[model samples]
Target: MKNFIHDDFLLETDHAKELYHDYAKNQPIIDYHSHLSPKELAGNRVFENMTQLWIDGDHYKWRAMRALGIPEKYITGEAPDSEKFNKWAETVPYALRNPLYHWTHLELNRYFGIGDLLTPKTAGKIYEECNAKLGLEDYSARGLIHRMNVEVVCTTDNPLDSLDHHRDLAESGWPVKVLPTFRPDGLITIEGAAFIDYLSSLSKITNIKIIDFETLGQAIKKRVEYFHKNGCRLSDHGLPHAYAMDFTEAEINNILSERLQGGTISKKEVAQYKSAVLGLLGGLYTEKNWTMQLHLGPIRNTNEVILSKVGFNAGVDSIGDFQQAEQLAGLLNGLNNKGHLPKTVLYNSNPNDNELFATMAGNFNGDGIKGKVQFGAAWWFLDQMDGITNQLNALSNMGLLSCSVGMLTDSRSFLSFPRHEYYRRILCNLLGKDIKAGLLPNDMEWIGKIVRDITYNNAKDFFQFPSYVEKAPLENG
Candidate 1:
């Protein structure tokens, strides 16, 4: 067997090895987007056990297990920790070439210095060792942040949240920065019966009398402003595709008025409402200088029976056949022509649309704005080794890879910090191999700087940092 998977592997050039080494060793983590709990970060809490930390909030593993036909007993069921570990161990070898394989190995190595493969043979030892260390004082949430060298993290948050957790973290003067991104998906989706209930929730949060369409608009506006005041500088939207319907404000008001009267909307009316309102939402984001993110091409809620049994996000969403480029172009062109567009990041899942997404991402930038309009990395199902490498190549060929802000885990797992390392390794290998073949120049200093910037510095500078700085070094150090 090979001594090491990444042993002196040079992708760009032989000389590039030194550069990759320097960058990988020193770069801090800047997780600009994720779904980690701000409450846990604020409290700096410790984990009860490795199972709770690894599997409790990870729907990815749950989805993979479902794919392997492992019953829910080993999944979200009431199985013992050892049994769950055994099941996960059984699934590890089958996850070959999956991002989970790399991530699992990287976490084991990074957190526990255990380089051995995890099969049923090694599962018990790995579990016991990790559990023993997790009982120590230095394994708290904040301590883990320090251990991983995470500089900042931005969490997806609802428009209705008071952001008390964020405020508390800010006031605590912790080393790591935890902030929020404004996610208003529930407020914007008007097709469901829950739209009226969402409206009620918004009404309570904004303290506005949302009696009609005009008041509804005002209530959303107020909440966006509230989120802005709470250190939110980005807005996020998840959609099947970009909206293309263009209609007057009065037309939208008419639809809202009908809905207020308890009238059911036609399919056409639903499209019209969603399209117009998404445009309005974009305009609001533009005016506020918020970096707007639109994630497209997901066909959510696929497993009807499982969806009914377990609800959404049990990992049933698949890619949709959406022509995102033309629609995105139309929407962004409208905004850009009006001079009302902010910095925009577009993310999609369909690999076939790579060229389309790359070209369209570059189209919205009229002036020489560095990141005014950009393409986000492979997200969700595409956030794997092959997926991220494909995205990097596409961006490099079509757009500017250096200017492109790189990988974000978008995960709920605390052990997912290794994902950043995984991305860095893949990136270095790609660059190193290219340089080795004399495709790119072997400039170690410049290459190292670019690696570090993409891995850490770019995201740190892009987002706003918290007010507090680091505490003084301990006397012993």
Candidate 2:
């Protein structure tokens, strides 16, 4: 029988095959955004088993298992690694059209070279095979990344993080660039129960005792400069929506002071404070020429019961219906007006806002840059096949698709790099389908180059990362 995944798996036409194989496949990956642990990369840590590497901390698979009524013990509880892998394998066959099905199998095939379909019957055999290979030298943490042809991995970090792991990786001079992305959601969010606690942590890290909003800015600016000195070039924010309301320094400072002193602030006060913080951080990013990423529109941690048990980002989050256009445009325009809008990437989890985001991206393009403002890659629940396709279609219709800094894993798994491969196949298929329908011309070479540019070149120029040449494995001096 033929394999389920093959050379031309998602490519439905000859033109698609040509674009993927000839132009896109071999291009190096610039995973500019991910939640991968910098410590793992720094230590080149090796997993004890397949479950540790594959199933553990994988909320994607956990959600699928839960959908099938699998108990939490088998998912995230203290079930044996074998049992967890077994439950995941069982969940796979039932996951049919879900993106998890494709991602599960793709990671299996890519990492272990196992072509066998995952099922309850084959789970044990496949699990053992994968664990055996995990014992290999090439299956080590950095080795896994090395095999994936990733050039840069920018991990999300808070302003107060030491970034010791990123610093360690950079100093080690591994061929793959492991960099930090300044993600200050904790800082931006002032309404959370832990906001004051987070402020204390930031103060401890920066030693700039925060008495008010202006002092908070000074502390965060110190951290941003610290990150810039340590080679950070990007900042990422996860907000329900943009907080670009009108506010003065005094108003924000007063609200922050009250909050800092354990006094509750009103909702409007929170918005004004968040807006001020975003604007302050935007100016810092602008000074360092760093890219700023806004991941908006997710009503996170809605399941209070599950949230209480599992903490946040445990897959209970869902797409939100927040108004994107006015708030987004307001924030971007405010920054642009102040010449503080660094290159920005906008992402909304709600599919309803695709064109809204795409057109908003077009509204801020200038400074001779190719894509100064980007309708960023599909994110969170939207990082699947259909979500990716819809995003590309929206961008193609509303903006210059060629200038798009295409596809990011936005994932926590090293194996998730294949999502980039999946994206390239989808991109090629879309263009090829267009050509087949006589919408685009029959020019292969030009179209092929566009594929390559989206796959790597656009990100290369867009990020302005330090030069990298993948070399041999690390050896003792």
Candidate 3:
């Protein structure tokens, strides 16, 4: 039979084919947000087999396997790597309408050149072929990134991290710009069980005494300066909702003291502490011209049993139905009023808030920045095709789609770069359909420029990462 993932797999019409092949296909990826390990990139680690390369650290596949009634031993337990691959192969055919089905075949075709369907019958042969490729130098971590034509990758990092790996990668002179993004979720989450421990770690990292909120802010500022000097120009936070409650510095100090002293604080105090810390960080981000990304509305660790076994990020998170609009507006407005609202990207996991987020972004889109406040790409559980289309449509209808920054991997696996290709095809197909239906004018040249901008230029301009300036220019399509 024919190849399953041909050049025109997702490109349905001639217009779609032209857009994908001519405009979107060859654009260099600027993966500004991902969970990839900086150590792996720095070390250039090679994998032993398909399971180690593909299935490990991929919670998407784990969730699917669990849904298929597969046991934990086969999924994440001490089963042999080959057996895990067999279980994943068996689960693939059942994921027909899921994004995993498309992602699986696309990754297979792109990486391993395997065109046959992944089922029980073809599992053994495909496994061997991929394992053999994994043993090659070109399939190493750094090599895989280079082969995908990635110009830049910004890995998420905690404030307490030493960033030795990032320094190593930068000094080694890898062609791909591997940088760090400041993620201060641990510092801001005062109510979490690990709050005190995180504070102690931060104290150790910064060598600052954590007696009050002032000292805490100083510690965070010190780390931000360190990160900035080390080529970081972005910060990210994952919160259930924006915290904008008003509180004085003294009140915040009191709250921090209570929490540090093992005193139980109320929810109101938690909000006050969070608001104080986030607001302070927002000012720092603005001062340094950093792009701040807010990922809101994820209800994490819902299943205690599964969470106990697997800890966090093992696919037990779901969308939250929290009250977002008022607090989000308050937070942004407070920063804007102070002229400290840096370029921000807002992402919501709840699909019902698509229009809410799009319009909210529009409310703060001035100051000569094209898309200063952006509706971030469909995130978390909403990264599927339907969810992506909904987010795109909402942004197009409510905001300026041309100025919107494009897709990112947001994944922990190196093989997830194909997700960017998947997103680009879907994008081109949408615009092509619009042109054919006369919803948008038939102007390929103008449309193509827009396509290229969203695919690469927007992010490159939006995030003025220090490494981008230090490195050579990216190749043109």
Candidate 4:
């Protein structure tokens, strides 16, 4: 029987095969945004089994297993590791047409050199083989990253974090650049239950008492400077919608004081506070010449029951339909008016906003930088093939796809780097189809340069990290 994951699995045309194999396949990955634990990379930990490496903290697979009627015990509970692997194997056959189907086979093939289909029949043998391989040095966390040709990884971090692990990794002379991204969502989430606790921690970390909005801004600025000195060149925010409410500093101060006094505030007040803080943060990012990424349109923790049981990022978030265009325009315009709009990337989870985001990015894109404002790669919930193609088409139609910096894992697993390969094959196939249909000129050399740039070079030029090629040679298959 033919294996499902062959060398040209997603590359359907000869043009795609040539482009992917020649230009995109071996390009080093610059995962500028991810949620991988820096501690694990610093420690160079090795997993004990396939379950630990493949299944742990992977909510994508968990969501699929739950849909297949697998119990939570086997998915996230106290089931034996082998039992969990068996259950995942059982679920794989049912995941046909899902991205998981391709991702599973891709990971198996790329990481373990296993091309056989994962089934109840092959699960035990495959599990044993992968587990045996995990014992080797090349399968450790750093080793796996090295094997994937990863050049730079920017991890999401909070305002109060120490970044000690990042320091440790750098001082240890690790070749890959592991940097931190400033994520101050907690500060903007003024209505969250833990808002007060978060403020307390920030105060402790910065040694600045948070009395009002001014003090809060000053403390956050201090942390931003600290992060910048430590090699942070990016900031990330996740919001259901952009906030651009009109308010004064006095009003913001009163609102913060009221909220800090354990008072209940209205939604309008929440918007005012968030807008003030986010606008100020934008100026800070501009001052330091850092990129700011806005990930919008996710309504997280929709199920209260699940929220009470498992908490956030546990696979319960969904696309939000909030009116994004007006307020998003307001936010960017407000920053641009001050001449403080930093290089920005806008990512939307809802497919409805694909064209809107692409066009919105065009509104603010000049200032000498090629892609100063970008419609980021199809984001969470939109990272699948159809979603990716839709985003690509929208950007090509509405903006300059040539200058766009492309894909990131946005993942928590070390094994997820194959997603870059998956994205490249899909990208090449799209261009290949265009050439074949006479929609685009038959120019493989130019197209191949675009492919290589999107795969690696665009990110290198867009970001502030030292060049990877200057430091070390990229690994090739």
TM-score of 1: 0.93
Give the deviation of candidate 4 from the true structure as CA RMSD.
Answer: 4.2
Residue ranges of candidate 3 with Cα displaced over 4 Å:
467-477
Models 1 onward score TM values of: 0.93, 0.97, 0.97, 0.97
Instruction: Kindly list the per-residue Cα lDDT of model 1 for residues 1-477, writing each as its tens digit.
Output: 652345453244455456557776568887878898888888877887778878776778877777788888788778997888788888888988777887788787777788888899999998888888886766777777678888778899987777778877877877777878989888767778788778778877777877766787788888776666666778888998887676677878888778766788877777778777667777777777788888989899888977786776777888888878767888888777777677888898898888788889888775656767778888888888788889899989998888777778798877788777777777888888777888878787787778887777666665545465233222211
Task: Write down the lDDT of every candidate, Cα atoms only.
Answer: 0.78, 0.88, 0.90, 0.90
The residue ranges of model 4 lying beyond 4 angstroms of the native Cα positions read 466-477
The digit string of per-residue lDDT tens for model 2 on 262-352 reads 9998899988988888999899989989999999999988889878888877889889988888888899999999999999999889999
Q: Which pairs of residues collide in model 2?
A: none
The CA-based lDDT of model 1 is what? 0.78
Clashing pairs in 4: none
lDDT for model 4: 0.90
- Residue 76 lDDT in candidate 2: 83
Candidate 3 lDDT, 170-286, residue by residue in tens = 879788988889999999888889999999988887789889978888888988888877678899999999999999988998999989988899999999988988899999999
Which rank order by lDDT, best down to worst? 3, 4, 2, 1
Cα lDDT tens digits, model 4, 1-477, are: 778888888887898899999999999999999999998988999999999999988989988998999998898889999999999999999999899999999999988999999999999999999999998999999988888999899999987887777777877888889998999999999998899989988888778999998899889998888777667889999999899999999999999998888898999999999999989999999998999999999898887865676667777778898899999999999999999899999999999999999999999988899899999999988899998999999999999998888999999998999999989999999999888888888899999999998888988898877432121111110
Q: How close is candidate 3 to the true structure, as a TM-score?
A: 0.97
For all candidates, what are the clash counts? Answer: 12, 0, 0, 0
